[model samples]
Target chain A: MADDSTSNTPRDHGDKTIEFSGLVCPVPLQDYPNIILGHGGGGKLSADLVQHVFLPAFQNDHLAVLGDSAVFQLAGVQLAGQRLAMSTDSYVVRPLFFPGGSIGDLVVNGTVNDLAMSGATPLYLTAAFILEEGFPIAQLKRIADAMGAAARRAGVAIISGDTKVVERGHGDGCYINTAGVGIVPDGIDIAPNHTRPGDVVILSGTLGDHGMAIMSVREGLEFDAEIRSDSAPLADMVAGIIQVCPDVHTLRDPTRGGLSASLNEIAAASGCGIVIDETRLPIHPTVQSACEILGFDPLLVANEGKLVCMVPAESADAVLNAIRSDKHGSGAAIIGRVVADHPGVVVAKTAIGASRVVVAPIGEQLPRIC
Target chain B: MADDSTSNTPRDHGDKTIEFSGLVCPVPLQDYPNIILGHGGGGKLSADLVQHVFLPAFQNDHLAVLGDSAVFQLAGVQLAGQRLAMSTDSYVVRPLFFPGGSIGDLVVNGTVNDLAMSGATPLYLTAAFILEEGFPIAQLKRIADAMGAAARRAGVAIISGDTKVVERGHGDGCYINTAGVGIVPDGIDIAPNHTRPGDVVILSGTLGDHGMAIMSVREGLEFDAEIRSDSAPLADMVAGIIQVCPDVHTLRDPTRGGLSASLNEIAAASGCGIVIDETRLPIHPTVQSACEILGFDPLLVANEGKLVCMVPAESADAVLNAIRSDKHGSGAAIIGRVVADHPGVVVAKTAIGASRVVVAPIGEQLPRIC
Candidate 1:
């Protein structure tokens, strides 16, 4: 069986030498003899699979960028001036319903957030559903209703969709894949590779709330205070930030592998080091207590309605203020800085003023939490 | 249990009065208390689910058009001159590999054909994969390789993709959802509602090959002649047809529920009657015999690479010639015509000179045939 250990020790694959190009798969195959749940985990195994298998198969200039969304200019002179962004994400969160959200709203907000990360104004979405044969119609109705409401809230239309039913045993209740298309406004180019030394990393709100909420339901564990998912759309907040800081280096949602994964990815792509103060990281009291009880690290837990922005130090205060003004960004804080030392590494400064390397999870810490 | 009968008797829902607007769910719910295999069969049940459940939830002008794709303009003055087409489909074919194609190629061609039906030049495709835990990596690689090859053949790029793994028994080996975006060329407007009276309906090639190819492998049935799937890309052929007949009214690929369903959909959408000569359909001899032995109606069996075109009488010859000249359209034939009488119904003239109403199948004839 694949290792289920939740160790924080950095793995060998978490190095700067591993890039998108010229990846050899046999080494990773030796580590993973068969597909595991961690392959879907947004961690080292997931990165290895994507870099070695998918990237090589579907290699292209746009995909090589590996941003949250693929932004490109539509061919032909008619659409030459307009750059469009397209993104697809499959939502397979178990338990369907959580404290604050369900798969329905999660899918819409997830794809919308993906487009927003690229500085695009999400316009349309396509929802494709894979349903189990015996799944309840009433639940399906509720899910669809939530999706429609979420789309309206995000100011985008669910213009196209598809449905397929698999045998009861062949599928979960339902899996939704929402693919979104948006228009990238002029004079805005945001990507992970844009991160540079002296960039300030600002995080939007409390970590571990979303992941902990799902775990609460799955494990039937309740905290002293209720922990609800922080799943909300972020396009408006992204627009606010871009208005104030157009030259923002990178924007990412701390989702699957949480803040640590996003930080490591940006550092590797931009050849910089990210250093965050553990004391400055935002955490909800209930979420923090729950993580402590569950022996989980808040830095490695997923957050649906959060963003990590990297901007030049000169504009850090402006970007931070812009994020703080949005409804979803009230708890935003400057938690980290990009530096020239230790490229492709993320370090945390503890309360004792000692630094420790914060490694991305090797596999899923909480399976299907997103 | 829900009805499994593949009766061709006209159901109550197959009438012109059943429009997309103001649809009530209780009526269809009575017919199907729960989703069955037929809900994904692309037959009357599938149509009812979409019209009652999905359409009502995601109501919009673009979605109401109900063409193979949703075509619209981006919301800005910058892209006012360009019209874009977007489509999504999930491929759940059994026995991933069939005689002439696999789920990989089927997914790529399926979305490409969907965009082509809107008279759009397919550009970029996003593939989302739902893989079952413990699935073979070699098979995954093979599928990815096939997808890349097929995308290259269709002249489109697989720019963005997402992968998620479900626990064993929660999924089949793999299910792929492909969402595509394409550009609708100038001066070309194609939609199911665009079919007008006196338009000539043309069949691109033989039917039932793709469906039978899967059945033969799935059931371990052998025939004298192998029935290879007629799975090929139709974008280039569609482009050629547009070059010859830019005013083509409607173009549809008779997938899932096949030619009869496509005809019924167009007839209802256009408020026109369709009459086809049964003897004129181009069916491969092996596929015809297989359908006969399997007690399947060829009219409702799926075709992957074929197209049904509706053109004005003046442009019929040019369109037919263009289709015939293409390699995939070698067996193209003029099969039917639109009539002013009996709107929302299809009639077939038997080889014995008798006329009979051709009703869409009520449910699935062969499940999981893509």
Candidate 2:
């Protein structure tokens, strides 16, 4: 985790940017070998490794492309306003089988949510995997069965995919990295920067259920109330919301860093402040109790089946109603309002009437141990 | 480093069934709350992990997909007697700065070579990075600069990318994963299955430069003659060969598992025998010295810039002539020939006329310590 100093320069984020100070490492990339691990480490060396070794091989117009997401004219709609959104995310939840969902469900739902967040119609997905040396035959059949069911529930096609097996120990039990390509609805341009101070923040359900559930299972701990993961696909809920209101400003799923990290990201990107009411947040009794005992903040926990939306002040109610219509969003609640005072910051009104600033999480409680 | 099981499986090679009876532990994707490092250990747990988790997530499309690499379709091509080919790889090589190439160069060239091996026109690429906390700003700039340059040389755009930062320690310095899509030319269907007796096996340039470069730098062992990584892009060379003879049989880069493993795979996949003249195999003098001192087999070493190409008996001379025209392929040589005996096995002809069977490497000597 030592690539921080190289990232926080005066060129891009401003020399005074205080972002990534904790999560970013401060190690100078150590170049060893004709190559070394850092090249794959996702640090400077990794970037350089790709640039120097790969780019020149097959230089072409398409290969020269670069963007957060590729923009193209899929339908009659052009790029700016009426473009379809497509994306993918491979869920490598450590436990193939979770307290609630299995890797099968996670793969479909994870990518569906990604497309939904981009305001896309989740149409199709591609699931690929790297199997290790000595995998069991029966276990594979069960997982395949789970995937088929999950895809059917999501109403999307498993379309196509790939698989490969590394020698044992070369790979984890199984690593699923999915690539989903969907079409963003026409006349919709939802991005991180679309959030406005006047927007109302809505959460589809209780926070931290998925993260806490996984954590509990991993840590071998339990609460009085069984805390099961809320790892369901959200594309349907997103479609339902769009059907009710098309003027949503922004959408995002608070996954890795949970709601707090997601809100802060939206705030920073939109240069707006977000104020949340702690009382408005819907936390399951089991999740709350687990957080209390674990000494971990629910805001920083991970989530598998949750979405955060910042809608126009005018359509917040309709959006909420539409989301609540879906079983996945039965716990829908209006949690906050985007504000102007603390640009790039998320401030929460505590249950005790006090205010606290929740910044992005420093590190993951659960490591690739994903 | 995990996810090495590529979906390289195609419908054609149904004969090569990988029997892992001796493998330690396969992908026994059980219902787990948290998976251990053993899943990636490349042994029994590794196989079980993949079988249980990944295989189900991506039910085995084919044995190739279940084996080491995946052979997938490339988009936008419907030529007679041909199929497009696409492959992708993640470069998490540690030590951002390497002897010769950086992560930037690796990504571009790695993807390019993959398409090249399929006799495809390596066209588009997408690079995604997960950076850890505290990466250096200056180093990132260097990598970006290097990436731009590499893309320029390769004559390709980086196309698109996504960046996510993990908390320090949770991630190494950084992890760069790339997905590439290419167009396979018509009249060209080159895969391991295409090999047959009387086919000529060609080795382009030198071997082990990339792997040795990584090892020496990582271990801090300096050779009298400094060794640099052979991490150049090979798309141009591929293009050269394709242009001259579209009938060229196969193109494959020997990377992670090295030439030995790659050759063995091709042998098994084709259900044919390969006899390589080990004495004629190319190895940089300095690299050979490093491998000797480290007690590493040169054949097991990685090659980022080079490729193993098996051409049709009729086109062998033309292919070699074509390859020698390019700088990267100037050192290409006829290393061996395909035979009928020892089906699904590679045989290297020793200098003294001794023959030793080379099976597809069972495991990685250089662990994901990629």
Candidate 3:
């Protein structure tokens, strides 16, 4: 009752304004009559859902930043006077396992990366498993092993966990929910809202690999060359950047909605414009052809192990070099720069020199891409 | 790979000792060749699953203690030099709403109580929702609203959350996973392993109310009186007891496997014997009758808001008085005491004077009661 609020912000209930406040008046999202798979795709639809549905319901200071992780200072709770970052994510990627990863590791790395986005060192993780009865024991063991291996690689402990089993048909094999806690250093203060006009945006690596990996496995689409899911713990890479550039403004993993949604989120959160060079976008040759064959945009494809950073222009080179030093960031490149004009917009400079708006897809181009 | 270990404890390789360490030789659990509803029922089967499955896979120092929550000290990370407690639980109760509570509040209180069991003051919670497509938005709003109220009641913030939607029929209406963090005051070290001989065990209130409440509504069982869920936040009550009796050895909410399981776990973990008086056990008449009619054991029925505290005999009276002072613990009673004999066992003194082994059920008598 205390949190319930009906937004007084006047808007054509039917209009396509990014309405952040209001009653759940079933104002049909002009294009989406029902929640399509894209709504969960981490694209424009997912963003809209968070902005229009979740934010209105749970509008708090920590959540207002719209960062991958919520970083806040818990005063007097600790002796070192350090801030803390906490995050939660549910992994529902279908097929469970694909070329390079499974839901188990995805569960760990997903939350780990979220903490990394806040410039925190992940320390502990909690896993909750929703299992469908009749699921194979062998499969469950495989997942657990992968989770253990992944946690070890990330130097975090799966300290607490829970498991609930639904009736056989009520659930797919399993859905994992993970929450993480990380300690943020005193000097580091990174969030999406901290982005400024002169900041430069850098991509940690290639895009579309994770989404296509899931799509290919689920749809049985085979390519001449295997496209593995680019799922890895990004904390080490993040630490590298922070080591050299502690004042980095923002860091986000371009997950569900691909790179476009991530850029748009930072743009909106900071009220700035982002201009990216299309030619500078890194896409593997096989991935490019596969996206073309499947009629999917590489720019809008999900990636799990990559990140986008908005750092001060002066710190860009050091940050880029620091990221490149990590094995996960070999494909790092400067893709864009923050601009003063067209605030709250993301633009892409075409290879031919014309600039076009890089709008986030309304929903996910591929479902269950993780 | 680092955590992988096969049991070194030698067994016949064929005996059914519920071997803790060994090969995954499918020792068919007598009658259960595969997972049954009872496997998830906080009974014997659930314990076995955790011991033979989860514990072996995720064996860590924190989990080895077997407390409702894992309390660990994060040194130098806090300014005031404090320890923190964290816990996670997934609520999959069917029917969504019962008489006194729903899965939403359960998600909050469950984790809060877990943190409380560690003698910590719960401060923050993270919620993750897995929704079934086509689930009425109205129902979701109702659930979220309930969660907000519960978090407010528990004096904890729902700081971060995630939402994932699965295709209709693939999931029940919704499954909520909540992970919580709390501040454990200095000099407070409460754990299952801390239970000592001569510790008096106190029951906060009536038993079997929550499970019976859910069972009645689900089975359409009519009763002379309504059985309301005993769902409330126990953190305040726990704090009350800790304030008066700081040496409270152990605290556990009789959830899942109910009182018998909680007692059994504490006994096994602490290597102590527990003797409980059946005559002192508090049970609502309506709930007792319902359990009788349904052929359910009251000892194995779940309680949501209630807790069992083990305190030194000298401080028992003060702890009991403090618990009774709290609204949620009005019916608090001393039901048992720790003993030097028969370590790792629980014995109930029957109303007729005979003592019987109070064994934890292998599975829940009622599925999804919590």
Which has the higher lDDT value, candidate number 2 or candidate number 3?
3
Classify candidate 3 by CAPRI docking class.
Answer: acceptable
Task: Give the CA lDDT, 0 to 100, for residue B61 in model 3.
Answer: 83
Q: If ranked by TM-score, best first, what sequence of candidates would result?
A: 1, 3, 2
Which of candidates 1 and 2 reaches a greater lDDT? 1
Order by lDDT, highest first: 1, 3, 2
Worst 10 residues of 2 chain B by lDDT: B1-10
Over the stretch A40-150, how does candidate 3's per-residue lDDT look in tens digits? 666665666666656666557776666788887765553455778999998888999899999987998999999999999999888888888766555777888888889
lDDT of 3 at A231: 96
RMSD of each: 5.0, 8.9, 5.4
For candidate 1, the iRMS in Å is 3.8
Clashing pairs in 1: none
Tell me the DockQ of each model, to 2 decimals.
Answer: 0.48, 0.08, 0.41
Please report the candidate that would top TM-score against the real structure. 1
Evaluated with DockQ, which candidate comes out highest?
1
Q: Each candidate's iRMS in angstroms? A: 3.8, 9.3, 4.5
> How close to the true structure is residue B157 of candidate 3, measured as C-alpha lDDT?
82
